[model samples]
Target: MVSAPTNLPSALAAALAERGHEVVVHTRRVDPDAPERQRLPSGVVVQQIVAGPVRPIVEQELAPWLGEFGRALAAAWRDDRPDVVHAFSWASGLAASAARQQLRESTLIRNGAAAAPLPVVLTFTAFGAEQHRRQGPVDPGLANRIRLEVALARSVAAVIAGSDDEVEELARMGVPRERVTLVPPGVDVSRFTPYGPSAERTDAPRLVAVGDLTPSSGFDTVIAALRGLPGVELVIAGTTSGDASEELERLRAGAEQLELADRVTFAHSAVRDPAARSALLRSADAVVCVPWHGPVGAGPVLEAMACGIPVVATAVGAVSDVVVDGVTGVQAPPRRPDQLATVIRGLLGDPVRCLGFGAAGADRARSRYEWARIAVDAERAYRALVPAALPAVDDELIHSNE
Candidate 1:
């Protein structure tokens, strides 16, 4: 269960569907007027459990909708039971836990026993400490969010931690080591292949960054970094066109102030399509991902690596784990434009090193962060709780039938 369509849950669901699992995503209906069920391109089924009008998940007012949402979930899952219900946020976990309890109670009283309590798994995308550290003071809902996350970790069959740091947090939360699984969020490597640096881009090297135009994202640092490399152009992707958001203006102002108007290009619309985003990443000579310290595997970095493009990312969260310094990609300190500029310049200067980083990154991404492997890992965790979840093929029966 998730509040809305987030990159992590949506990607995992699609990957799981591709792995032959019947993936049904349960989430809130952001569009009150639109259909509740959406069939996405990757063949995952989505069912929205609408509590009320659309609201952001992080807002404090969302707390009142929990009970209603849980009932909706219970109703949705009654006939079509899921082998494992994986909740993607603290609020979603609360709803899932309550719904699961309700289902169990009803099953026990109505039938002889409950159909072995559905192995509920969880993924808290951000650690509270990391959140506080990155943004300074925490939100009003943060303390409760952290508490709920800990409770979910203790209750769930397994926790899908994107980084090893999360596993440590789970241990501190008193969640058993056996129940925590280090399954980093993955990227689809098929479409994101390195088309070997663009043949058309002969004028100057280009660096691309994917995400929204926000202050905390550290795009200003990229703009600052681009000042030194006059030849290198920085492409900022994810903001929509014709909207005067202050964040966007601030970035524009920063570029102007830094005298980088010609060097920085803002692709004002988010390339939501994977193929398009992959194409954008593939077109670039290198990708820069220097967001403030946050959750692991925020999508762009892994996608860039998968596309066989070298990345210069800050050493935080999963970026630290995935990028092997000089091997796969370069790492810089968060909020440091000088280091980022130096690394970017170094990569742009040496085509061989950039290609090597791309090649190595592609190899690492394919071997360790493939969706098939991640799905199998998730399935294994589910199997630990529900041993009969996946049945083995009967080779003898097939042979006899043949």
Candidate 2:
């Protein structure tokens, strides 16, 4: 992992580590004064790189960071190497690819013959181009990002998608179908389990909405839905704290303008921690995730389900792939407050059905979206790319010869 802040790589590294696989996270934080190395609770080694100034995630900063990361990775791999290099994003993929190339070249120089390219597995959580295409006119680095993804796809042995929606995007970007694997991003199911008794609010149906405060997040739509469902309060648990973000202010203004100030309470603090977030999810009657463009990791949705809370989400992006409409929970079309209100009302009206949905969602989350299962799938994808590691190939060759 090259970028340190994102939770996907950290969650994945921790998950893989728990599965008895060694995970080394290489990253650089914007705060140069931060610690150099730290060990995560799950036993993964996180080594921070000493790159340049604090910078935003743009092409200018990304290219230089990739170079810095590649050099460091190659140096480390040269001493005590790893079997496979798995990168979290396009920038990290480029760095990992460069390191692999350097290692291969060094091996060739030492020996008479060239060895096979070191297996590299890349996970692009979101394509910049794809996101731009969805929301109308293309973004600034649209061409550059697409070209980079296409180039990396050709070089990497395997590409693991965060969501099934990304699989088609990967294919469109020139990645072979065989090279792509759809592994939905996972949540810490063990911690987020719904083993405890329900914390239902007797006064009113409390609906929880967890995610960023951006306009696309659809908190406004959820608020609109709440107008029809009287006596229900919506708790928005993820807007940034301290000086409120523009989005947060906008949301507060919207709530006041809609005369929903009494019915809605913004948590103000972003619930990034799994335990806290899980607790927040558990405290709700139902969790609502109605993103206009769809969620990036489907984190909030999966976390809510894992906490045994029925979700009322818009059927968009990777959400449609994970949620079975009316089975696990309810699905409302984007920007439809009337339809969304009806769905939420139905779930709230039937306590038995809400309990059933919660139970079903929890079971599904445990079986399919658990971190352990996700880690194993990712591990297998990496192992499949490594020729020396795939001893089954040798066994097959021997059998064929016989």
TM-score of 1: 0.87
Candidate 1, residues 268-336, lDDT tens digits: the string is 553666666777788888988887745645467878888888988887667777788999888888787
lDDT of 2: 0.74
Point out the worst 10-residue segment of candidate 1 by lDDT.
393-402
lDDT of 2 by residue, 1-402 (tens): 444344337677777776666667776555567577777787777776654555435433567567776777777667856666777777778888888888888888999778777667787756776666677876566767778878998778888887767887887888899999878878787788886544444577799986566677788898888788889999998643234477777888888998988989876453755566677788899999888774345777888888889998876677777777888998888888888898899889999999999999999888998888987787677666666645442121100000
Pick by lDDT: which candidate is best? 2
Pairs of residues at least 3 apart in sequence or in different chains that clash in candidate 2: none
How do all models score by TM-score?
A: 0.87, 0.89
- Model 2 off-target regions past 4 Å? 1-3, 54-60, 110-112, 197-202, 239-244, 268-270, 388-402
- Per-prediction backbone clash count: 1, 0
